[model samples]
Target: MDDCIIIGAGPAGLTAAIYLTRFHLSIRLFDCGSSRAALIPCTHNHAGYPAGVAGTELLRLMLEQAEKYGATREQAEVTAIVPVAGGFDVQIGDRTAKARTVLLATGVVNNRPDMDPAEHDAALQRGLLRYCPICDGYEVTDKRVGVIGTGDHGMREAIFLRGFTPDITLIAPGAAHELDDACRAKLDEAGIVHVDGPCTPIRIAGDRIAVETPAGPLTFDSIYPALGSVIRSKLAVAAGANASQDGCLEVDEHQRTSIPGLFAAGDVVKGLDQISHAMGEAGVAATTIRNLLAEQRPIRR
Candidate 1:
């Protein structure tokens, strides 16, 4: 049995493993290499990278850091997490691992526009598509950008991007005229032009991205999908953890969930979905977990 079993290997899970191992706690970190962090082109909001860093490069460095502390990593997916006598039984394929504590750092999957697998891959890698305005809005400063979504998420993204540039447009390609009157007023107040149409296949070029809508062909330097993400909190939720409507888990100040030995952090738990925020949350959760384990005494013979 290990002291802790951490699910997900993004900034939160990796950071927690590093901190836990330093306390001499045995940990097994499971990851499937599907972290959204690796999809980012370059993140400048994360601290210490003044010049910014590619998401894949940042993930690699953190993996090395965790491995340096002798942290064990399992390249498998956790199918389920069942609470057991001591703590929890983590199901990874045909095997189960027992741990005195569990940390769920499974991040969310972003909602993106549909395209051919290869074309989408090329567009993302080429940095013609973007996400998380908060992470790289400055990079799009004074540049033409489009928010390809609707409802509150889309409206908020356009308003957020307004801070970086006034050349922002909101596109409701599939759901034309879906924005309510209030939302339209808000967009108008923010000076965001709304284009309605069921757009055809998106065309990506070296210099820009173009979407052929019924209104016309709209092109932009980049487009952000504000449709939100699918929170990977099924394990926690199945174990009786509370989650918001958006499926984000609820955690206390120490990142403890409704279950005592089961805790959560990072994008899996409710809060800012930033790398810095995730790391800070992991630090708090790891320290608190250390204190929790210290109170356990061995059985007397």
Candidate 2:
């Protein structure tokens, strides 16, 4: 039985693995390899990378460092996490592994419009489709931007993006911007342009994103989708952990869920969706896990 089982291989999971291994705790890190971090082209917000680092490259380096410290990397999709007598049974398909503690870092999946697979992949590679503004909104300061979504979330994003530029456009839903009078007034006060209709046929070409609407072709230097996300916390819930409506686990101070012997960190846990924050939370969780295990280990004379 491994001392800890880490689900997901993103920054949080990798950091936890590194910490656990350094403490001589047996760890098995499992990842399905569909991390949102892998989709980012560059993240200038992270430390040490002045020019920013490709998400894939950062993940690779983290994995290499984790392995160097004796963390066993298991490239398997965790199908189920069943609580057992002592700890828990981590299942991957027909296989089973034992762990005294589990750390869930399975991050959320950003909601995206249905598009051609190749086209979406190309957009992500080109950095045209962004999910987080706090990460790179500074880079596009003073540039025209389109905030896509219909609800208050979209309006809030448009208003938030306004901090960087006043030339912001809110892409509303349906054939009209169905915002209430209060919201419309809010947008006007913020000096943000509202496009009363859904954006369609979003295409990227040569450093610009063009959207087709009833009003005509609208173009922007960049686009931010505030469509929210689907946090992957089902495994935690299935294991008796409490999660929010958005599927984010409600972790305690030690990152421990309601279920004993199970902890969480990163996007899967209720917190900011930033890499730096994720790493910090994971570090705390790893230390807590180490202390918890120490209490359970046999006392040496």
Candidate 3:
């Protein structure tokens, strides 16, 4: 059996592989090739890249680094993880591999707006569409911004974006705004414009994105979908690991889940969804795994 099996090849999983391999542990990394980080056109928030780096490029570099250190990565989806006597059985179709420990790094999937796939991707490439304000709010500094969401989630995002831009509009995705009185007050206090939706037929024109609202057609320099994400923690949860109501796996300070020998990091865990944060968690998880395995079986050079 391998020392560990890491699911997901995002920044978190790759970081873990690098650390575990350096520790002289036998590991196998599995990736289904759907990392949310791969969708990022370019991220300026991640440190060490003053000019910024494309998500795909960053992932490529990390994967290469891990491979250089003897990390074995399989480009296959892991169907299930079953706990066994001394380890776990990782299933990939008809095949199964046994590992002493498992690390989950499956990230979350963003709930995108209802728009044409082609147009949506185009807008995203041109910076007319965005998701995480914390990642790129500075890019919209002082520019007109539109947030497609409602209720508390929408209100909070609008307020957050207010730091980067004074001109903010909150558009409901449904037929009307679901903002509570308190949410409305917060938006109003933040000087954010609220528009009733059933916002539809989002169009990209010139350097702006236009949204059709009940009030009328609205346009902005960029649009952000404040809709929440679907955390990819099902595999761990199915294996009896504790997870939050939102499906984020619950981990201790050392990234150890309730299920012994099972750990989680990145957006799959309940914490900050930043790349750096994920890598930090992976580092902690890797070290913890190394020590735990050493206690089980003596480690020697």
Question: Which candidate wins on lDDT?
Answer: 3
lDDT for 187 in candidate 2 is: 91
Q: List the lowest-lDDT window of 10 residues for candidate 2.
A: 113-122
Candidate 2 structure, TM-score to reference: 0.96
List where candidate 2 sits over 4 angstroms from the true fold. Answer: 298-301
Per-model CA lDDT versus the true structure: 0.87, 0.88, 0.94
Q: Write the per-residue lDDT of candidate 1 for residues 33-91, one digit (tens) a residue.
A: 89999988788788888888988999899889888989978789999999989899999
Q: For residues 55-93, write the lDDT of model 2, one tens digit per residue.
A: 999999999999999887778999999999889999999
Best by TM-score: 3
- List TM-scores for all candidates, in order: 0.96, 0.96, 0.99
The clash numbers for all candidates, in the given order, read 0, 0, 0
What residue pairs clash in candidate 1, if any at all? none
- The lDDT, on a scale of 0 to 1, for candidate 1 is 0.87
